[model samples]
Target: MEKITLYYFLVNNKATLGLGENIKLLLEDAALEHEYVRLELDEAWNNKKVQLVKEGLYSGTLPYIEVGGKKFGRTVPIMRYISVKLGNKYHGANDEENQILDSAADIIGDWFESAKLAFNGSNEDKKKYVEVDTPRFLDIFERYLSAQEGPYILGEKISYSDFLIYHRLDDDMALDRLADYPNLTKFVQSFVERPNIKKHLASLSK
Candidate 1:
């Protein structure tokens, strides 16, 4: 946990915003020592300083982490590294748990891509996503959540994947559409009520 610095962009895209905010929220909730350095368009994509020292980093990419004087890339991997730095509270307790963690993370990634198709794809693609694809994913999410014994997938102990799940649901404005999604509704309500997250949610409104 030596001098952790997260470099993220100032973008309007909710997905990007959610990833960066999720990192900050986790760190904030843990009271971890961290700093968020906002990277402008030039610094993120074409900075000479970043280029000169980018060789040893995982992807030499922005939306990355600089910790212990080293860089790590890719969203899920960086979150995993953060968990390790924080004594692995968000990590799985064993191999079986790790399998669940990885599987859940993969599902989150896949769901994002499917949602992206609705956002940026052709009209026909969007139509099918709304009428067919979205309902399908929502059903998948509902079943998985209902099968869990606690609010989170891994029982009461919240994992890193839960943050992404919360964001995807919130970003899609699914927070208000909860007539048939009781488990998901509980997830959203409980997530927003977490102390640090509740404060952040309030700030977003004002």
Candidate 2:
């Protein structure tokens, strides 16, 4: 089989990982062979390489993937495609389960989008969102996790949703704010401590 190729920007910052890093983690967890094509964000966009990628997907987007002679853009769809290809249980057990998983992922995506806005919005807007909108979403996640047999989002099996939630919360939210929700805090802790995940994170720092 052909190796999966991921195209993403190389950043100098050690504090954050790009969206492609999540895909790299997924590939590691799935024990799949892959290669990365790291590009300087500015140069890639100005050059023909990124233009070719955009033409392939018909979208001007970064963090693209080429696997099995096909192209995928955007994080969520790429994750779903790879999970299915690797036969990872993360895709869920059936269509209904997959739908449930997709719903959770979409909600998480929305939360992060709102978070970005909150970070850049006016002081009053930020305060309203952090004090009001943020907790509302956190409550939804907490309630869902509390009701489930977790450690994970769905149940006994660790799915992409678990990684999705963990990455966003760990990367985007302040640790102090996470204290109010013990389940979410624990969820992020457990996720980071997983053997493969732990190793992957350590490698990033180096």
Candidate 3:
């Protein structure tokens, strides 16, 4: 099999902590060979890596990916594509469950995009993003989780959606009361104990 290459356009820890972390975890869990090359905006602009940026700028933003000499933008699509290729036991075992998992994955992608802007924006914009946007986003997700059964968004087996949601909630420190939603809390807790993810969590401090 030809090696798959992936370059994650990231800045600091925050960038890696969210979607970047999700993709990395997914890839590792699938035992898929990959690489992460951080894209430094300043260095790229100054050093004329803009062309490379442009090529990866399918959606004109970071978290973009280059795979097999082709650029793929948008997070969920990439995640799905990789999951299908790797034959990972994510997205669950059936069609209905897979759809639900995919929908939750979309929610996670939307929330992460909102967060990226919120964190990168000016103080005023940040306030609006935090106060207005986040609550709305979280409310939608909370309901989504409420509709599900225990220990996962879809219950029982973990899915791609779980990885995305768990990473966002845990990394952002946005969910205040996990106890309020016991199932979601337990789901996240279960993942937190996974070997690959646990190792990455520890590496966050270094």
- Top candidate on TM-score is 1
CA shift of 142, model 2, Å? 0.9
- Models, CA RMSD each: 2.6, 2.6, 3.4
User: Cα deviation in Å at residue 61, candidate 2?
Assistant: 0.6
Candidates in order have lDDT scores of: 0.73, 0.75, 0.68
lDDT score at residue 113, model 1, on the 0-100 scale: 89
Among these predictions, the greatest lDDT belongs to: 2
**Per-residue CA lDDT of candidate 2, range 39-143, in tens?**
776653677555665568766566778878887888888888777766655777888778878888899888878877887799997998878987888887887
lDDT measured at residue 124 in model 1 versus the true structure, 0 to 100: 90
Q: Could you tell me which 10 consecutive residues in candidate 2 have the lowest summed lDDT? A: 11-20
| Cα lDDT of model 3 by residue, 108-170, tens digit | 777877888878889998899767886676677667767756576776666777778877886
TM-score-wise, the better of 2 and 3 is: 2
Instruction: In model 2, state the lDDT of residue 193.
Output: 83
Ranked by lDDT from best down, the candidates are 2, 1, 3
After the best TM-score superposition of candidate 1, give how far the Cα of residue 73 lies from its true spot, in angstroms: 1.1
> What is the alpha-carbon lDDT of model 3 when measured against the actual structure?
0.68
Better of 1 and 3 by TM-score: 1
The runs of at least 3 residues in candidate 2 whose Cα sits more than 4 Å from the true structure, single-residue gaps closed, are 11-15, 48-50, 53-55
lDDT tens digits, residue span 47-110, model 1: 6446735567645655677777677777788888889877888887888887887887898788
